[model samples]
Target: MKIAIVGTRGIPNHYGGFEQFADFLSQGLVQKGHDITVYSSKNHPYKESDYNGVKILHKYDPEDKIGTAGQFIYDLLCMADARKRGFDIIYLLGYTSSSVWQRILIKKSIVVTNMDGLEWMRSKYSKQVQRFLKYAEKLATKYSDHLVADSIGIQSYLKKTYNAESFYIPYGSHVFSEPNKEDLIAYGVTAYNYDILIARFEPENNIEMILEAFSKSSTSRKLLLIGNFKHTDFGIRMARLYGEDTRICFLGPIYNQVALNNLRYFSNLYYHGHSVGGTNPSLLEAMGSSSLICYHNNDFNRTIVGNDGFPFDNYNGLKEIIEGKRKEDFFHFLTENIEKIKNIYSWQRIVDRYEDYFLSIIPKS
Candidate 1:
């Protein structure tokens, strides 16, 4: 099958979730002998045309100069290019800026869109932008041949709200087996002695709330934050408010996958405060890394973690959990999560699911 993937920045995964998905999924498909072409941004560091047997098509991305509005242009460029390619499947990763131009998508290709989290619910966007995102969601639903929801909650919402059926295929992660205690030395932390929270320093991610909760706790353990917090206004404010605390360490964004996995594996507690996303990749990664997880209490999160994690709704709840009794052993939760990673959310399993789904929809020639 000739597949073209659109809607992410690029393949080498310089960015977040969707890029990582594209990187892993495209390579996996290629391994299965499928012809895959991933649309990458011109700005991506990877200048090569091919990555690990997968074809990379670099399109002009003006987001750096024109800001967020540039994404619409970038999407348009990708869609225009895709229309000319005789692809069996044109997978749209998200609908944020591309759905508005859905009319231009190739009619011969079976258009399948991954309906990301409810962007309208994000606190970072203004009311006007939220309205636009809602409209985009509608466009994406109406125009695409099929829809994919990364979480059960998202699937249910699509059915309830749009009366539309969607495939529930969550994100995937690899279990971290190589745990090096030396990896912790560079970060100035010891194994299983510090707590960590990795997320974008955005309002909806509950970054400040998690930091506050950690601050309120009396434990001498360090609270290490991993994200780009210096750029945004809210993040700057958070830095000022919590910077004075000696125990809180603001470790900026670390994109290296092995480093991140090592951090999660060695951390005492991994905090996921992302309340808006569906089947978040980071959450899956924490599980795969065998971190004793504490996630934001929501359907999207609960669907993945199930009974294997500590759920916290607010700072007070999280603070109590932090200060509460320590378990003699957290082997049960850790083992259960690891098993889930191996059985359900592993990269191989996820790739197989995607392949089966695609084959089911696209008739054999």
Candidate 2:
């Protein structure tokens, strides 16, 4: 089957979760002998027309110059291009900017949209923008031939809010068996002597709250935050407030997956404070990396981790966990999370699920 994957910055995963999903899913589908074409931003570092047997089509993306509004234009270009591609399936990774142009999508193609986290719930956006995002979400549900929920929480929310049925397909990750202590040397940390938090510096992510918890705690372990914290106002404030702490280090965005995996694998504790988003890729990656995790207590997180990891609702909760007892067996959480990655969230299993779902949904000729 010929497929075109839309909605994401590009392949090779320079940006975030959806790009990573596209990078792995497209390549996996290609290995299965499906004709896969992925739409990329014109500015994506990979300049080639092909990547690991998958076709790459770069479209205009002016997000660098004009800011977030450029995303709408880029999505318009991609959808307009996909309309003429004669693809059997047009898999949209997210419905943020492209849903407004849903009418322009090919009538013959099976449009499967991955309904990302509830955008309206994000604290960064203003009330007006949140209302607009709500409207956009409605349009995506209305026009798409099928919907995919990346977590059970999202699936339930969709059914309750829109009365819509969706396929529950979570994100995927590979188990990291490598623990290169040498990688930790470059970052000035030792094995199990550091804690890490990798996420975008957004208000909803609870970065500030987590930082406060660490500040109030007496743990000697260094706290490494991996994200582009220098670019945003909130992040700058966070840096100004927390930068004075000798234990907290803001290493900025580290795109090297191997380095990240090693960091997570060797860390004493991985803090996942993301309050929104369904089945977050980072959370899954942390689990797969053999790290004991402490997640923000919410349905989106709880549905994925179950009782496998520690849950913290606020700064006080996390503070206690940081300074409190080691009552739970450490190895048990690590092994259970690894088992989850292998059995349920592995890349191969996710690819197979997507392939079968695509085949099942395509109208018979």
Candidate 3:
């Protein structure tokens, strides 16, 4: 099958969850002998025409210069280019800017969209933008031949809200071993001596609330926040508010997977505050790396973790967990979570599901 993946900054993933997913999924599909072509930004650091058996096509991406609005242009350009190609399927990772382009989307492909999360629910966007997002979600749903929900919560929401049904396929994870304690020295921290929160600095992620909870936390273990602190207002504000705390360290964005895996593997606890997303990549990675998860209480998070990790309703609840009694059998839960990665959320399993769906939905002539 000839497949084209769109709606991401593109492979080799210098970005977030969707890009990483695209990289892994496209490469994995290629390994299965499928013809895979991924659309990339013109300014993407990697200029290679192919990587890991997948073809790379570049379109004009002025995201850096024009900000959020530029992404619309990029998606439009990708869809325009895609119409000329005879792809069997065009897999869209997200529907943020592409949904409205439904009418213009390539005619040669079956569109399968991954409905990421309830974008309209995020507090960061204005009322106007949220309204558009709600409409966008509907348009995207209307245009897609199939929908993929990364979590049960998302699948339920889609059905309940729009009467849309979606295939449930959660994100994958890479299991890490007992970490190298020496790796902590490079970051000026020690193994098992700190707790970590790795997420984008956004209102939906509850960065400020987490920082506030840590500010009043009685535990001696440091709070290491790994994110692009300067990227958004929430991040900048949180950095300013919590930067003075000797126990809180904002290490900025650390893209090195080895360092990140080691950090999570050795950490005392991992805080996952993403309140909007379904099957967050970081959350899965943390679970796989044996980081005792301290997750925000939500259907999305709870469905994935079950009773395996501690849950928090708010900053106060999170603080209580931090200051309260520790779970005696946490090791067992950590091990179970890694097993969940290997069995359910592995990339191979996800790719298999996608391939099956694509084959099933191919237009019958």
Which candidate number has the best lDDT?
A: 2
- List CA RMSD, all candidates: 1.1, 1.2, 1.5
In model 1, how large is the Cα lDDT of residue 82? 91
Off by over 4 Å in 3: 325-329
Candidate 3, residue 170: how far the Cα is off, in Å: 1.4
Model 1: lDDT of residue 86: 86
**Tens digits of per-residue lDDT for model 2 on 1-365?**
99999999999888899999999999999999999999999999999999999999999999999998999999999989998989998998888888999888848678999999998888888899899899999999999999999999999999999999999999999999978889998899988888999999999999999999999899998999999999889999999999999999999999889999999998888889998889999999999999889989999999888788889998888998877624235888889889999999999999999999999998888
Task: Compose the digit string of candidate 1's lDDT tens values, residues 198-223.
Answer: 99889988888888888989888888
Per-residue lDDT of model 3, residues 311-362, tens digit only:
8888789888777634344788888898998998888888898888888888
Whole-structure CA lDDT of model 2: 0.92
Superior by lDDT: candidate 1 or candidate 2: 2
**Higher-lDDT candidate among 2 and 3?**
2
Tell me which residue pairs clash in candidate 2.
none
Q: How accurate locally is residue 194 in candidate 1, as Cα lDDT from 0 to 100?
A: 89
Give the TM-score (vs. native) of candidate 2: 0.98
Please report, in order, the local distance difference test score of every candidate based on alpha carbons.
Answer: 0.91, 0.92, 0.88
lDDT of 3: 0.88
